[model samples]
Target: MEYQYCETDPFKRPTHLLEANPRGMVPAIREGDWASGESAVILEYLEDRDRDATHKVPLLPTDPRLKANCRLWIDHINAKIVPSYFNLLRATDRTNQSEGIDRLQIEIRALVQAADERGPYFLGADVCLVDIHFAPFVLRLPRMLSQHRHWSDPIPGTRWHMWIEALERNPHIMATTSSSELYLETFDLFMNSRLANGES
Candidate 1:
């Protein structure tokens, strides 16, 4: 299937998208007559579609237990980790921001422990749904943390750094990530504009 990219601005969304997804959030997909919203659901839809097509390498594991585990982690990352990271980023007050960072660090450590059990990727040797779900945020994390002047090395010798390093080498991840320079520039402008509006 051919993919078409639509750049959306949350502050001023396009009418067609608003019709498809009233919430106006991004990462939505439209497959012919069917349209769906939310990242996790979209990932599942793509994975199921590919599996049905008998793709050479299915994104989800074949084993039922392993597939369930992948879904669990994906939910955790979306529901817990991503929100904490965003809270830290948008916080205008120093104290609240610091607390938010601390919470994020705790969440990261938990994620590290989870990934360490499987090694390399969240689901053993191969990149799976968990990795795909979290990759976009993980790619942006180092820069986002640094921009706040609250950067610190992930506890020395932990899988936190190793996991990030391994992810950097993954072909799929590399294809998805923006250049650090571009990400930093865009993020700076976004934060500044949001701050100017007294948003948190």
Candidate 2:
């Protein structure tokens, strides 16, 4: 499948995008006359559309119960984990920052404990929707936490470390990910702006 890039600046949203998706989100996709917004919806569309085809790996499992579990974890990450991480990054004051960090640590531990019994990826050996949804945020961890504080090992133990290692090794993730240095530079700019605005 081919995709066209439509660069969206949240500060200067284009009219075409507003027409396609009133929400003005960057990841909104338009296929022929069909259009969908939100990362979860867009990912589901892609997965469902290609499910019958044998050429590509299915994003969600074929088993109904497992598929439901994947969706649930994806929702958890989107609703709880990612927001907390963003809050931690955007926090300007030490009190708020500490609180954010604590919240994120709890979330991370829960995620780690929920890892599949079989191995690596969230759901056994396959890189499912949960991995896809969480990868963007987790990829930033190395640079984001390292630069901020002395507590380097936020996610301890070999299991989490191996999981992260597997994610970094995945070709799709590597292709989509920005360089750590570049991500850190952009993150620092965003954090500085948040500090200026006195936003927690």
Record all residue pairs in model 1 with backbone atoms less than 3 Å apart, i.e. clashing: none
User: Once model 2 is optimally superposed onto the true structure by TM-score, how far is the C-alpha of residue 187 displaced, in angstroms?
Assistant: 1.9
The segments of candidate 1 whose C-alpha lies over 4 angstroms from its true place after superposition are: 52-55, 116-118, 155-157, 185-200
Per-residue CA lDDT of model 2 for 62-170, tens digit only, reads 8999888888888889889989888887666678878888898788778877878655889878898989998887788776765773224544446777778888899
In candidate 1, what residue range of length 10 has the lowest lDDT sum?
A: 1-10
Candidate with best lDDT: 2
Q: What is the TM-score of each candidate against the true structure?
A: 0.83, 0.83
Clashing pairs in 2: none
